[model samples]
Target: MPSETQLAYFLQQLLNAAPLSALYAMLAFGYSLSFALTKRADFTPGALFAFAGQVFVYFTAFGYDRLWLVYPAALALGVAASLAYTMLASTLTGSKVIRPLSQMSPNSVITASLAIMIVLMELVRIAANTRDLWLSPFLNQRITFWDHPGFPVVMTQIQIMNALAMAAIVFAAAYILQRSRQGRNWRAVSDDPFAAALLGIDPGRVIVFAGLTTAAFSAISGIMATAYYGSMDFGAGLMFGLKVVMIAAIGDQSSPARSAAGAALFGLAETFWGAYMPYVWRDLAMFSTLVVLAVVMRQERRV
Candidate 1:
């Protein structure tokens, strides 16, 4: 039988990361979309993620909450940002990197992306620090327990809503991807861009939509993250975005739902090991798992 403390810890870990997993899933799907269209992995999504949330906060400050403009506002910012990135990347390297090895070398593009992320994040820091910017206390309300056995889960109002919102957004996206014409186009584009283009599909349009969808999903995901903590801190998106990239890549960027699974597993591992192992082993354990996972997935992909 599981110990009482163990049970409590497990449930808390789930509760904490389930909603958080949605954030991961959203970001991962975003990355995956871009990968699907461009046939490349990139870090531009990372910058878009951070800058999008900042846009949300900025709009909310502008008194645009009744329609909950934060969501769309963030998406628009991301669209603009990702659009600019796509345009520049295409103009500079779209034709230059058609070699087989160039297909695997996202590092050069991602390196350039790092600069965008840094500049965007620094601007956010400067703005928030120098100007009047404060998030509304969105999560002060907490769900109360009925004081029953295994029934007392103290979740914040915002956390609960954010979680529900995450679920709704993911479900909607998944459905659209599976059922809509545009989504089918995306699948065809992802399946084989060259083949799809030969079939008269516009690869550039596919890519543009893919990037737009990525930003759209990121809007929902980023704001939910903002609501989860009841505060927005500059630079937080970078850490979380990196983890999302790692997890998405680990899943080969093919399984979008794996984003959620990856997040939950990551949370569970961190909680379990942190509780049972020495602090020195924590980071090692996580990285080791990542390495092991990469190796295992490679074997599967090989076959």
Candidate 2:
């Protein structure tokens, strides 16, 4: 017979899984927006994100824990790093022959993004010195919720903050994309850069701005991930960034919201499968799912 402890553990997993999944969904959407606008993933987003936690730690190390400053400092760093990435990628895209040959298509833009990611990783390794990195809880606080007797769930203020931050970004991004002139221009550029350019829209600026905006959001994801969990390597962005890419790909890059859903689903699948399956074969299962999804989707895409 199943014990009460077993039942409680099951419930606990569900509760934890839901919030984590939601976080994945939000981060995935952030990356999706970047890919949607610029057709490239910001590979260095995690470094900027991890840097945010380090910034918080650095400020705290300097004895500055002003709640107001935490996000601002993080945002500033994210903007700076992501903006540089955007500019560099734009220069690369402008030089690529595929764009001119294909009349400014996604192929060259994506290639530029890949190149930019490699550069960002090397730079992060140089800048951070590859030493120990981590962040103590920003709040040093915890919360408890009880669904029933013996079914209490515990979480930290940082996790709560992550949840809130995800909510704010989602609502804000949706509103801006739906009701702004810049948003319309972004949509136009996304559909066909050549058409947008003929309309007197500088495709170069659009791509850079799009990359910049996405990088900014990616930074937010990094900071949230690091601040919530504490510390990350310069190379940590690769797995996380690729995960975002996979989520976007699974969504067929059609609907950003659906991409978010794919992210959540991916997170849940990863978490659950990792637990039930052997450690050695863990990724085999997760990635195999992605492979199958890709094959099926590609066939559908052709049709």
Candidate 3:
């Protein structure tokens, strides 16, 4: 049995994990949506995530200094710029790269997507001049949930808001995927693009829809993450993208709800690992687990 202090600490850690889990779940939801359509593990979303966050930071800094604007005004401008550029990038990739290479092998698509990731990372690095930019923190007031003699469970206001926001987006996306006509088209295309095309559904258009929707998700998450963490670096995109890919692959990638659930579990695992184990080994352990799961699943399929 756990003591009062131990239980309180446990609760505190759980609360801390909520926001992280939500972020992973949100990214996985977006990734799974497009992965279903493309039938390939596209690395573009990760790059877009990093790109959008960095772009927001860059423009916000510009607006704050060059335009002599307040934080709110600068943030608004940053949001607008991030959304515009992310969607444009996603559209171009979907049309020029993803669509054109659809008939090629999955490895071909993965290679092209990785190449795009590198290009976007370079663009971000060059634009920032290899500088790390940061935002002023806001809504950081701590909210205590359970108070005890030696331990108290608490979370920041912003963390709670971000978690709630991610949950809303996931639920909304699941609803759209299950109940909407466009959702039907997305699933149909994922199952059989040729059959969908024969049914008068343009597979290319479905891919465009997935791209745009995913861009929106990436932009929202990127902006929020930058606002919360004060900074987003160039290398974060690929790592985040890869982590979400692994999480989504563990779930039914074609189903948003299942993917989100899987991501949430990953998030909790990460948080718990950080708390109980050597923090340095957190990523290595989680990643190793994912790799093992992938290999086992493959072997099962073969059997």
Candidate 4:
């Protein structure tokens, strides 16, 4: 049996892990959703995430401290911009003109996605006239759960919102995928596009829906991240996007639930590692674990 101190430390870790896990889960879902249609990972979401924040902050700055109007306008513009990027990516990947080429070389799709990411990031940098942008902190209020000698568990409103948003997104995705006609169409298309088309389900329509849904996930997560950190850099999205792709791939990309679970596990590992280990070893430890897991998974598949 563990002592009270051990339990306290564990609880503290859980509190710290929740928001990061939620963010990772949202990103992973974006990757999974896009992959369901294209059968390839889409790197576009990361760029969209960064672009969403930049657009939101840029619009909000115009409001001159009037949050009521600023917030709505900023959100609308941000979501619209993100969805536009998604539509572009969907068209590039699913258009009849490109489909033949992409089918011949799947890497062509990845290359196009990378190109989209680069172009968007560049556009955001030019629009902002800088690589970094900051937003005024909206929810800095904290709620303390427990206080111990060396373990204090407290969360901000933004953190709670992040977790809640993630939960809501997951439930909504599950319900739509399992209970809706469009969801059934998406699944059928993913399983076999030719068969789905024969059944009167249009693969192009499914692809567009996947892209839009994934974009919404990325945009919401971008908004939450900016709200939590109060600032963002143009280059941050690439690393975030790649990490999400890795997490989803490792988690069994076909299942959203598994991808979410993988993200939660990653969050817990990162939190505990940060808490217990030196800062220098933080990323190294986490990534090394991921590599080992990937190798093990690959071997299991072969066996």
Off by over 4 Å in 3: 299-303
lDDT string for model 2 (57-86, tens) is 344333324344465465454445444544
TM-score of each: 0.75, 0.75, 0.95, 0.86
Give the distance in Å from residue 284's predicted Cα in candidate 3 to where it truly belongs: 0.6
lDDT of 1 by residue, 244-263 (tens): 66777676776565654665
TM-score of 3: 0.95
2 or 4, greater by TM-score: 4
All candidates' lDDT scores?
0.63, 0.61, 0.86, 0.74
Query: Could you tell which candidate, 2 or 3, scores higher by TM-score?
Result: 3
Colliding pairs, model 2:
49-222, 49-223
Query: Residue 188 of model 1: what lDDT?
Result: 86
User: For model 3, what is the error of residue 67's alpha carbon versus the real structure, in angstroms, after optimal superposition?
Assistant: 0.8
Clashes of each: 0, 2, 0, 0
Model 4, which residues run further than 4 Å from truth?
Answer: 1-7, 65-104, 149-151
Root-mean-square deviation of each candidate, in angstroms? 5.7, 5.0, 1.7, 3.4
Local accuracy of candidate 4 as per-residue lDDT tens digits, 1-303: 347678788887788888888888888877787786776766777777776666666655545354455665655654465456545644554464335646698777667767767776787788778746566666778888877666566788888988888878877887788899988888899899999999999998887778777777877787677767776677877877777877887787777768877987898789888988897898787777777887787688679
Q: Cα miss at 18, model 4 (Å)?
A: 0.5
lDDT ranking from best candidate downward: 3, 4, 1, 2
